[model samples]
Target: MATIKAIVEKSALAGPRSIKISDEATFSLPAGDVFLPAEAAARVMQAYGQAVNEKVLVGMVFPARDEGGWGAVLSFAKEGYVRDDDAQNWKADDLLHRMRVLQAQSNPVRKSHGVPELDVEGWAQPPTYDTTMHRVMWATISHKQGEPDDDAHRYVNYETVALGRDGHLLLGVASHLAAFNQSKIIADGLLADIDFDNGKHYADFDKTTDHVAEYGLAALVVGVAAKKLGLLAVFLAFVAKFAKIGVALPFAAAAIRRRFKKRVPARPVAAVTTDRQEPR
Candidate 1:
């Protein structure tokens, strides 16, 4: 029977993160195997390591407390694998898959089972994404290590919400599991790092946690501003909801031209003779 294996890579920067695999290969023949390619793995692994490291480092720096960090992370990650400026942005789905595969090879139990464990030998192809939003990944790794029931694994799941056309907020929730689901990893250890919240606005700290709390708080804060400022915020919000068409929005039936009210040049009236003679 095939067994699961996991592997980790050594790097100075961000990784030592592993990928996991659940099965073994049938046989080894030519060097150019479809699934297992030797020469390409080194490049793929480097890219994968960089992707994971950046994701984690950015989160740590921003810290996701008041939505500033979370929002930044979302904006950075979801802007396509390559940006308009032509910089490469690693797609989340591709990175997630690579991590899973790499970890599988490093599982440590493959030797005892006599199965062909790939380990984190390396990666062949770069990651590609199907879509930018609505992604979920789950992987489980079990290692006895001569300890009683030493089954340990981790879960990293998150979703991003785009607000209007301008901004986005990301909510990345991660949890670790050891010995089945008997314990809560977030509450016990990871709690301090994340500072998880049920989504409350700072201005309305007194209010109870409820649906749309952030929205309500924003509205309330805007309401407190002087009338002109408050109105501007409300108008900006409204404008963002619609598609940007031209210099002026075509919202109402009256199509007010952005340039001059009327383009027709004024007719030059006959100049009245300033020095009008006594008798015309």
Candidate 2:
């Protein structure tokens, strides 16, 4: 097992690199952040106490700014073309309620791992979909159960998803409530830079020949995607370098992904280099 430093040393500093995820999608990784290939990323995750036990491919990590620079990458779930014709303008209350239900279902797992039960406090950004971009963006603010309902004690998970002709690309960032705004901006920007190949773009889908995903855009927000893709195992972990939030909680998020691996089947994500250039 390589040390974290060794892994980072060997990884590509993708200040401006184009990443292709198994031909399903591509990322024009913007300036600032290193990109770890699967093996190296797996090593880093193990060092952080998570076993790479999921059937899914090990995901690339562009460590949050404090750890390295900051950027993003997406983990592709080749479920199928997601039908979005009728999926528009979902209510925030409905989505948040679903999130809370998912949280309740997972509290037992958290307790088993010696982590405190967590509650979905509210949204840092309401569930919103961008029709032009073919994307869905939402963020949840959560707190350890039994904690006071205040910002300083909250944790933020900002999520962004880009749909394709195949499955969808999941990109996200986790931070304390204080970092939510900056993190959201970065996530939104990163999502905008990713694209699928010409024949693979969401608009390229052919109803006569292509398959559609079981869940629509809203499931991506409320955790229903967890059942089909089991994306929690591929979650991005953020570190704030001993942030001064008014809580005694640990700096990193609880290993939420580690708990859901048993359910989602595996799919390998092979990063094929299609192009590279300066960050435009």
Off by over 4 Å in 2: 46-58, 63-73, 146-149, 224-280
TM-score of each: 0.20, 0.72
Count of clashes in candidate 2: 1
lDDT of 2 at 38: 64
lDDT of each: 0.21, 0.56
Q: Candidate 1 lDDT, tens digit per residue, 155-187? A: 112221212111122222222222112112111
Weakest lDDT window of 10 consecutive positions for candidate 2:
271-280
* lDDT tens digits, residue span 1-280, model 2: 2245555555635445787778777777555444667666666555544444333342554542343222333467788988775455556667677777877887776567554677766766665566766776666767777767777667666676778898877886565677666666566656656777889988898989899888766666566322311122223332332121122322232221221121231122221121221110
